[model samples]
Target: MPLSFKPVSGLRLRWSRLFQRAVIAAAISVAGTAALQAGDDQPNSLPPVLQSSKLRLEARLAAEQGDFLHAAVALEQAALVVGDRETAQKAGAGRQQLEAQGGAMADFQSLMTLIMEQTAPPAQWIMRGDETGTMTPYMQGVFVGAPALAGAMAMTFDNSRLSTAAELARTANSNSDVLETSALRLVSLPRLEAEIARLQKSGQPIPADAAALAGLTEVQFLFVFPDSGDVVIGGPAGAWAQDEKGRTVSTASGRPTLQLDDLVTLSRTFADNGRGFFMCTIDPKPQQVQAVQQYASRLQLSARNARQETQKLEELLGLQNVTVAGVPADSRVASVIVDADYQMKLIGIGRRDGAAGMKSYFELAGRDERRGAAMDALRWWMTVGYDAIRVAPDRRAFEFTGRSVRCQSENQLVKVDGSREATGKADSANAEFARLFTEHLPQLAEKDVVFADLQNIFDLALASAMINTMDLDRQAGWQPAVFTTAGGFETQPVEVPRELMTAAASRVYRDGSIVVQVAGGIKVDLREVISNPQSFTTAPEVSSQARNASPVGQTGRWWWDAAVR
Candidate 1:
């Protein structure tokens, strides 16, 4: 048993460093364009081929230095500047050269995919409002000021690797759903008369039938003894039961169950219980638990680092928080909150004009995109950065004491504590957003690469609705399965009650998100957490019909998106 909850370093941004690269790239691009176009007024003399080539070279340099977004934007701008020139002889030749040169775009795509897979904000982040108009994030994403930087930096880690490992473990243990880690117990009590005879012959106290023996079922046990320190038992179903006084009931006899404080009585009772069960426990030493936590933390940090790199790219491309508010009408950003933990308890966009306003969550954009590409770009930009936010903690510590039960049945005899210390850390969304933008925003904007289709639409709400319909909400920690493809990952189908069609449908409408329901839409979140492909027979069922109402026709659905994806 180990504490599953532990704090790991989060992704952090280096604002100055990112901004410096953007400025340099923009300067080169603008200067090159001006110099090349000096002689020609009707058509630029630099030629699309040379422009693309120069941009390509710049991309190579940026990527080599780990400025992926800048690199990607450079290549993208080259393409845009040369649009339709793909048919011209010079343009075709240049395109061929660019394609032939181990292009960086593919690498960019792979990197973005990895970031999306690895990055996830905590499940819930708390936003606090101060009368002074400054806000603080509570839980996981926090910022700490760097000495003399005049601004702050926000950091948080990722847990994708742990999730992958756990997933792999589950896949390998398909046949054994319940992990066997502790001792298993099996016992058969002899008849009262037989027990008495055995006690007499062995010069032992007679076991009493009136005595109570408790058993645990499907429980794994971690037990620590004064000398042994730690041991793990598989299927620990039975242990010496503790009485009301919180003392170990070591033995049963005609007199009364007696509490034992020493190993003599404990060992004698187990020996007396016969060879029916072995009492084992998982490691209980604090250090042992800490060791597992460190392992988890390492994995978390790797994920976090990867995520931060992705965020850097997003910020550089102007694909994160492309919208911000409250700046003086004429004020260019004087000081930016690099890691502004953009969190909202609620956000609603007016159906009439998409004038979105947020209540608990801060608005990254001062004004909503009015229409067309601006709207699309705004959505794409916000989506790309959403997974990087999380809750910040006021005071963090790292203490935990929890048990892991592994068995269920007779001879249970294991108990141990192994949870790790809980640590509280700060989360600052404002600081992160500011750092990414202050340096990289202008460069990305100049390149005109304003949108990134890097949105993660796993849409927890859709997944949960599907699960509710399946009636699996009663089960705790039953996560949805995911299946990914070229189009993206599809959520696992979930189990639901036959009657929750309308309830599920309404949830989808409220979110205004579209998903392809494999089965007409019966509200199944299992699509995301479907580990047992064989066990899942029904796909999610969706219909154009309103939630709860009967289908109007054969075309009517209970949980299908009316809007095309």
Candidate 2:
């Protein structure tokens, strides 16, 4: 008998068995402790008995002990750890059964409900274009929202043009022929949190900070064109026909008729790699954007503090009468301009001339003494050079010519300027700067600077100035207005909605097509448009082609079927 036992099949199998035994032993020990303390009136204060690492063992032990409530909780925890919705549902059913048997635990029941709810798959509402006689989809989009928020909404755009460097990169590397076609999906925070929780329980890697998850509810996807010719057909020809249920079908002889619902469904069912289908769900809840804004407000406040500190430092240095001029009248439009000019003025009290000289100079001026008395008094001192005089005036102005160029395949703004010189009075310097800037107005009006470039410059300048000049202990956080650059110029700052910012960030692809799914917060009220199909006008007939019949020369029909099935 001592020589009868053979080694295990593999080291992995042996290790797995050892691990299982250890987990079982630990679970039993914990269960024993729980049982001993079970009689304590306040079970709510008890430590967690089941752990994700030992879920299976805990479930088995609880079941053996006839502790159905604990068994149900263990089962749910196990399912969550495994990320198996089906298993979770099974645990939910088992918990319901336990509840019916005798005394039901309210906390256990609530947990079971939460597990079931969190694991349930979302519903998809799809929309398709009405154009007919074409295989290419004109417009196709879908909506998906979480169950948590009752009124969350999301939006999609067709024929959107890309402007950001990131978007352009996505388009260039995409395998799909239609680079411009893309989709944006928005999700709610609760939905995101649920996903993160599930991932955490499953021991999957995710960002540890909850704030990192903020503003991440948006996702993007590309749409790929479908293959030509039907699989059933030996040639390129295929027919559009009605199925028994009145659904539009694409098929050939001796093949299954693929029912077409919307482009997303078609792509998911027929296309490879989910090219035409958005791979993620997005939260469309308003709270998601509000979270971003709250963070943004904090950053804005920090920036304001930095500016105030800079002003105080300037006062302490006695750099009075400082005036800034030639800044773009519209800071928002400055980014798109081809050039910017600036002028600065400062009053320099005489250096090392002592406080008495400065006081007497100010006192004499305050008394309205004529220019001759001050000039004569100052001229009596040969040591004081005219240039070193307390009130010696200085003015500076410069023109920065900007050129848009592509660097590393990304649009960039390059400034060209080397010369610096002392100019005339503040009025002349400012006027000269303004005149030079106005010369580039035509170019600014015609071309738009890349939003990425503008955002980068603004963020860097603001953050660096705060950290370096103001000597801020913490780096100032500034939120760039990238959202405003994406087709949001029409609306004023106050009038623009936060949802528009989300939309701008998820703009249409470069090729001009877009798809989006939003879930949880505000609902997109497409119910009226979806329900009242009859209200839409019908497309006119094309060249005597019979209704429901595939046109001879045309590849496909773009129009929706009036009578499905």
Candidate 3:
């Protein structure tokens, strides 16, 4: 009856190995079955090839037949199997085309490329500028192409500080011309130099600026996406300016001039290096109104009653309209002015009237009671805190300055409640409750407290009840309520809710000009810049220039691969 059992280590190991083999066999069988099913559904009419060109043709045929999913899958398999640069590049292009055709299976590489296509400054634009600064006092234009295409993109920036409106318009036109011409020159620089050499040989006059081409700084950035998922950057070797002595000098690193060949080497380095691709609109008041209206429509659909409540609140605030206007000046800071029209709801209320309203709102606990208290707060705020609102010259934006009125102050407390006796002694109980609920409970959750922990749940519930009670007391004009024990009530400092304190701490009340930015449906991808630095330094395709000459209607800014058709 007392027989002992001995452990068998070899038996356990053998069983584990057997289980693993069985699992692997099952997985292989499932995969094979799925592949066979797919083959049955869409029989490959052509032979699978190791060449990128053949794969691309196959993929294109599939796409034309509205089979982008199969095209993407086939191209990806070819790229992986062939493992060549050209095949990989074709795979990348195929993926983009599939995405453009509303395929959802695009990988990270293609997504990155799409982002770059949308945001990266054109190669020509990059060549013209040493560096690009964001949020500067200038207007920027971005050009993008169909995801299926490559080598045709650009962006431009125009200064907004001309003296007159007419002058600004004229300058913008001139700037566009300058940017286009500069792009053309960069792309055709080699041809131009060759022509210049021929002219010199034939004893023809060469422009004085012809020799300046050799000194043009070449900017190269290498983006390496290695298998280990690291991105390494290389040089931006060329961005040179002429010194006082008429010698070429780099604007940034003071490095030696880089040539086109050097840029190619850098690109090759990036291709060999990185694991991932590099990572890095709107109008004025009528546009603002349109956006608000659209949002309102959605809100109405979701919650009609809530929308009605919001309209009532807006009416109570007497907010007619708010406008934002910007003035372009010589300074780096763009000046924005906001003007607002207000018609105070309870403007003519006297002190007696305010007291009566507070009594009705708080003591009677009448519906819409907060409206009276809000009026009192607004009247006090306007009288003691706000300055007169003024309209700007354009009559679009408004400017006004005001400080927030603190209701916790003794004067403000008396102004709102009419008595210090109404302000109950604050105790640490409420503060403790807030800390336990807002801070400690969240910490417990982070610490992986089990759902079965009844004690923790009970503590949380107690804290929530305390917070609710405090909120109710505050609404009844008995804020900072003191809990009295058998002994007596202890006088404590007024305790503000942690949420209110957080909100107050985050508020930025400043005297600086306001800038209202409307996005222009563009973004920048630095990875693209790093990968193709030479392209930026060369002449853009003439077809790209033609496309940029005209404006195209834009759909929505955001797009999903599966929904892009």
Candidate 1 per-residue lDDT, tens place, 333-404, comes to 101111111110001111111111211102221111111110000110121111111111110100001111
lDDT of all predictions, in order shown? 0.19, 0.20, 0.21
Tens digits of per-residue lDDT for model 2, 311-411: 33222222111111112212322211111100000001111121121211111221112111100101000000011100000100000112211100000
Who is ahead in TM-score, 1 or 2?
A: 1
**CA-only RMSD, every prediction:** 30.3, 33.8, 33.4
Instruction: Give candidate 2's TM-score.
Output: 0.15
Q: TM-score winner among the candidates? A: 1
For each candidate in turn, the TM-score is 0.16, 0.15, 0.15
**For residues 1-565, could you state the per-residue lDDT of candidate 3 as single tens digits?**
0111110000000001111100000000000001112222222354444243344444433332222333454455555555655645655565555434323232433423322232213111121123221111111111110111111222111311111211111111222121122221121222333444456467776432333333332211111111111111111223356545333344553422322222221121122121111100111122222333333223321122433433332222221121111111111001000000000011111101221122111122122211112111111101011122121122111111221110111000112111111111111321222222222322322222121111211111111121221122223232121121211222222211111000000000122211110000111112122122231222112112111111122121110010000
Candidate 1, 353: how far from true, in Å?
15
